[model samples]
Target chain A: MHMALKFVLLTLLDRERITGYDIVKTFDSAVGYFWSASHQQVYRELSKLTDQGLVNFTSVKQGDKPDKKVYRITRSGKQELQDWLHEPAKESPTKDLLLVKLLNLRADNVDVLLEELDRAIKNAQQRASVYSGIEKTYYSKTQIAALELDDLALFLALRKGITSITSHIDWLHQTSAEIKKRVANNN
Target chain B: MHMALKFVLLTLLDRERITGYDIVKTFDSAVGYFWSASHQQVYRELSKLTDQGLVNFTSVKQGDKPDKKVYRITRSGKQELQDWLHEPAKESPTKDLLLVKLLNLRADNVDVLLEELDRAIKNAQQRASVYSGIEKTYYSKTQIAALELDDLALFLALRKGITSITSHIDWLHQTSAEIKKRVANNN
Candidate 1:
């Protein structure tokens, strides 16, 4: 497993006590916007974090459903995350499939490029709408007034997602307009 | 090898006739800004493209130096690229390590978060500067005046790269300010 997964789990646990299922749900909800991990990977990493003393799990008895293990960061886990977070993360080139396709454009295939651009714009708009919904549902005005530092952290992440997507949509529109102009000129 | 590498090479070869060495160099330059490919993956994919008849290469023998195999896109390869470019790409969640780390921030570790944000800003600025340089060198006003559709394609990609990075830097600064304000509030 990637060491990044370990830190992702540890950092998540730092926010709140959550069961393995909640961890997966959290990923699907907001964390998915930044990084991805499989359910198996999350469960596997949870056990490893337990053994390493980075996290501890509590068994809560339930009347009907099976007892669940709620997990949270231990002292050592917080220490570990603090140390790791201070380091400068290396940036790698992000793969934008539409941008790659854009480089394949030819003069005669202006419509093909336009078709691709339209699809890309639709995709980005869908994402931005979903993100906007998440922001409203999870970080409402009332919630914002009462936000803890941890809540602020997630809020910031959500904000980042919306802004980035907005930029992509802007670029898509600009590219579309520029291509249409070039076609009009027949240069 | 990933199928993406195949298209990356074909799209590149569509622009010019270049050897295996030149492919690697191009990847490091403009192409490297969007997608990543190792030299070995590129070499492997090049041969696969040759076998598939989507690309052809000419072996030019040099004096004392080893022979060079220069590659070019076949007609079929252009058709392949054009067809693929039409399809709407599935969007995946990009892995941004810093954003994940931000979700782990605590009130007491404001300075730690600040340090991380500082590093992120530096990394982004460095990349944005490099891309700005590429834009100047490869797509100057004089060059833009005479650009073919292929050059325009690359220019659009470069322009997209700059806008995206600029947005990230803006986010980094805003997040830093917001975190500091929260620390001050202590509410």
Candidate 2:
């Protein structure tokens, strides 16, 4: 799991040859959904991957722009990604900020926490709507049938995100009610 | 969020005065629910916190054993926790290996992934059940009412975990079915 960055890099390279800057941009949008890394970190990892021979890069010159290095996954990198895909997935540990806040909440702050929980629920709803749009665009039966394996896999990941967010929203409402009841009783 | 280690240390200190070793043990069981840190990292963080005056420990000698430094939260630490509790939580980026694998899946690996998904579903079910037992034991309404703010916070965190795992289990089943359908169609 700690080598998640490597997988992210390999996954990107598997799609198309890319430069460090391109990887950073892609990470901010698509890959950002699943992972976050700094531009510097991406460059650092790219260099390390190149050094390890898991990835190789070639210089590309543009007419008006400075020359750039475009990286591609080596055979070893592809093999590594395949091996990792077969490993059993462990549920990631909890790192939700709202959950952390809930765990350390003071009695006096119950009202504020409830308000924040409501906000979180609304946020989750917005995210779900956004993800559902993507689903309709790319993961519907017709689309899924047409997609190649890589695209289909991404669709599956998007599906998980949508499903997980929807469930979290449901729980937020239920937990909100529960907390409100407790507060009422205490008062 | 990068200061997560600080919060982890404070959360434990707020529970009771505990040694670095105790923190390692607690992380493996209780704190293991939401966060992970190596034992060496825990020791390092404890020393850092002590230096920062956010936490302080007194060295106590044990007969025929080396001295132990038991740490406790300082006033500053408590204040910091309160401040953090009020700060809005950003959605932690997704890092689930299953999702990552799914995003990069190969066509031939569908069968293997389905088997693993089934295993993951079982694991989520087991985790949810375990969390339910803990809820029954320690987070019943009566127990919650009697608990201090810190305990209540922990209860709330536990609630989120249960909700999340249950949701994840539901998603896994749904995803499994979807994958099966795809596999059948492809075959």
Candidate 3:
């Protein structure tokens, strides 16, 4: 199960009963900047959660439109989310194939690794820029200029992502320089 | 199983056949920069791997000391490592309880939230400093400065981490200032 999705479900439950569309809208409005789930994925997860009895849904009809499903968290769902929250964090094991291929590069042409790193760095930078734009759109200079202490945590997470991506770009430049130096020395 | 332990085992296997003590030495020499495994943990893992037939060990008599067991990876072990390397990446889910409490500060004292954010910012800054040290130790002033394409990939990953932490610090400062401004305006 996706921990972030579970957390999102619990948070929605904390508020009053909401429709699937409403949950999607809320996520898009608030947590969407940090956590993203496509509408289809959200709908599918909602159904799964309902089947698991973690959530209950009631059909509501709007004028001339198909009946909409509204959801509320069950007591069991809340308990599960709480339990997960209190659990000690498991170490994140990341396997970037790019890194693996790079590790094997001494036996191959170095140009391949250089090209991949360049692409990867560009990708990271693009993501960072996109996240920055999302932050700016959500929290205006005037709005950020007026945020209360309680409201700042989300912004901080956004900043964390930005910081991480920027540092990655800087490191890429340095590493590229080092590789070039080694090649020259060998020649 | 700790994925870090697996990485350690694989790295050791990358070198020639070695005893458990030699594995520890290699870890201390190179991997210590990015990953750490206790001596006890290493020995235990080695024994477990041997029991599973993932590694073959040969008994060697030393002068006046207990017999030592030198280990080499079996074909099965290499296959297992390769399988693990090809596994899909798992998305990491992070939920900081501290942030949750801060987000709810609207129901409590604002001063508490401010103090919490201040403390958090300081902590993050300290972590960034540590990462900086790791970078200095691992990559600083190396003659082979240019990364071949593949080597560049690993460098980029490290860079991404550094950039992320630094941006986090910057976001914290901006958010703190925003909260202060809001409080002043409201008063």
- What is the C-alpha local distance difference test score of each model? 0.84, 0.79, 0.63
Task: Residues A17-88, candidate 1: write the lDDT tens digits.
Answer: 899988888778778888877789899989999999999999999999999999999999988888787776
Model 1 error, position B147 (Å) = 2.6
Candidate 3 Cα lDDT to native? 0.63
Candidate 3 residue lDDT tens string, A62-166? 889989887888999877755554443333223334444344344244665566667767776877778889788877877864554445656765665666567
- CAPRI grade of model 3: incorrect
Error of 1 at A121 (Å): 1.2
Sort the candidates on lDDT, descending order. 1, 2, 3
TM-score for each prediction?
0.87, 0.88, 0.60
**lDDT per residue as tens, model 1, B28-139:** 7767878877778788889999999999999999999999999999999988987777666667666778888888777677787788898889989999999899888777
Q: Chain B, TM-score, each prediction?
A: 0.86, 0.87, 0.65
- Model 2, span B52-170: residue lDDT tens: 99999999999889999989999999889878767776766666667766666667777778878888988888888888998887677666667766676677677777877877887
Binned by DockQ into CAPRI classes (incorrect, acceptable, medium, high), candidate 1 is: medium
- For residue A45, give model 2's deviation from the true position in Å: 1.4
- Model 1 CA lDDT for position B89: 68
Model 3: residues with Cα > 4 Å off, grouped in runs: A1-8, A15-33, A36-69, A73-109, A135-140, A146-156, B1-12, B15-116, B132-163
DockQ of each: 0.66, 0.57, 0.20
